[model samples]
Target: MTEDSASMAITLSEQDKTTLRIAAYGSVTLLSAAGAAGGSPHKIATTGSIALGSATGLVGHVLAEYPKSKELNGRSVADIADRVLPALTAAMSLLKEQAPEEAENFRSTVITAIESATHHGQPGPVVADMIRKITKALDAA
Candidate 1:
């Protein structure tokens, strides 16, 4: 993380840090799927690269604050989906405007990721609720 990034994350609580991590992970996953969704590679690459850069920065911020640990990381992922739902909604809205087909692709990719995350154990009501919320957001977008 850059000095600025590290500084910005210093004041965040653990929950906030977890939310940032989840949002960044979601952004990267969606953008990667978008890049592969058959389009002008140049356009997708341009947009994906820019968005990935920002998302990676946030990921770095979270990582700097909390080093990777399976226990903490697992719990964080389990707790993060609902908290980051709004961020995901906003991202879906933007992608829908900029690249409608890719938006759908991104939404599916996110759902898959969420499902995979839940496979290890049951996600709490929050994760289940966020999945529905994300589905609605993506459909509306």
Candidate 2:
């Protein structure tokens, strides 16, 4: 957390933190899964996760803590999206309502992670589409 965020009056509940964590991390997971058929899913996941871990500010504080929530269980990509997409929207809504700067930080962090997950060159059609959905969800709030 930065000095600015630390000085803010914002106080998020545990569940809210969990939602943020899930929303951010699950995005990387989605990209990894989407690229599974064409390339190295593990590489995508690792690169994206590293990006998330590199986040800063209040969003960084929230993401640094491992979330204990079990709501991310999804046997398929569709199942995962069903949970993550809404979580992303919810997280943005919550943050924007309380701390608008943090909201932007979170958005940039996730977008950076998504871009890093591609690991060079342009993203494929499927990954690009998934990225669109993720961005849409984030902006939905």
Candidate 3:
């Protein structure tokens, strides 16, 4: 199969993946010290949720626009998960210097984002495994 075809073999849409990707980035940022310091922990968490939901909704709309194009179906859930974890870790590191509370909130947001992402396709176990692997490295740091 062609590379595009191979990637698109999965049922999930590119828009779905992209939404998750964007949510991952935004969620990671919310976990950053700058994000937490700029607002309350609850606020940061709630905003992150809203941002992720918006991205996911956009993904749904985008998927509807290209119902037959597998181009919009490319990418496995694992691939999307890979993008999320590293971004979160990096964001946390940069924000660590700001304060302990910020770091805690940042970590909290990352965890919540992972939880939300898991609620989509496949089982929660698969998503949890990816999150565990990524956090393993982060925890070591």
Candidate 4:
């Protein structure tokens, strides 16, 4: 058999598998929220549920991945929040296109989350950049 035809298997540790799953689920969930945020009340409800579920999954994944490292877990959570903020700002912008007041609410919610995530210390350049981008988006929305 050719190399392409031969049976090929790859293995990952359980932790690695779980991490991959969590990342995939988180991305899909966030994308779905962004797509649905401009729709009706039912769609908003669905998006909210998915967002909460994804947050829970992330918490569990962080706990599993850094069971004995508080500092690591905190840093990981902050990094994740930073990464997610842009997508979230885009989603809020979509919501703004549909409902301006509700979009403002969403912006406030995001600002609160960002503040909570970064309140422990001064944000570095990366986190500050994310905050600036998010603020500009929210303001323009």
Give the best candidate by lDDT. Answer: 2
Judging by lDDT, tell me the better candidate of 1 and 4: 1
Q: Between candidates 2 and 4, name the one with more favorable lDDT.
A: 2
- The better-scoring model by TM-score among 2 and 3 is 2
Better of 3 and 4 by TM-score: 3
Clashes of each: 0, 0, 2, 0
Error of 2 at 51 (Å): 0.5
Off by over 4 Å in 3: 1-48, 51-82, 116-124, 137-140
**Candidates in descending lDDT order:** 2, 1, 3, 4
Q: Write the per-residue lDDT of candidate 2 for residues 1-141, one digit (tens) a residue.
A: 656656255788888898998899989888988888768789898999899999887888788875554666689999989989999999999999888878999999999999899967678888889999999999999
Model 1, 1-141: lDDT tens per residue?
664454444354565545434443543333333333333324433443344343223333443342233322323433434434555665566545544444454565555544543444444454455456556655664
* Model 3 / residue 109 / CA error / Å: 1.3
Give the C-alpha lDDT of model 1.
0.44
Computed on alpha carbons, the lDDT of every model, listed in order, comes to: 0.44, 0.87, 0.41, 0.40
Model 2 CA deviation exceeding 4 Å by range? 1-9
lDDT by residue (tens digit), candidate 3, 12-76: 44544343344344433324222333334354445445544443222323222322323222254
Which whole-number lDDT from 0 to 100 does residue 57 have in model 3?
28
lDDT of model 2 at residue 25?
Answer: 90
Q: Which runs in model 4 stand beyond 4 Å of their true positions?
A: 1-90
TM-score of every prediction relative to native: 0.39, 0.91, 0.38, 0.37
RMSD (Å) of each candidate, 1 decimal: 13.2, 2.0, 16.1, 16.4
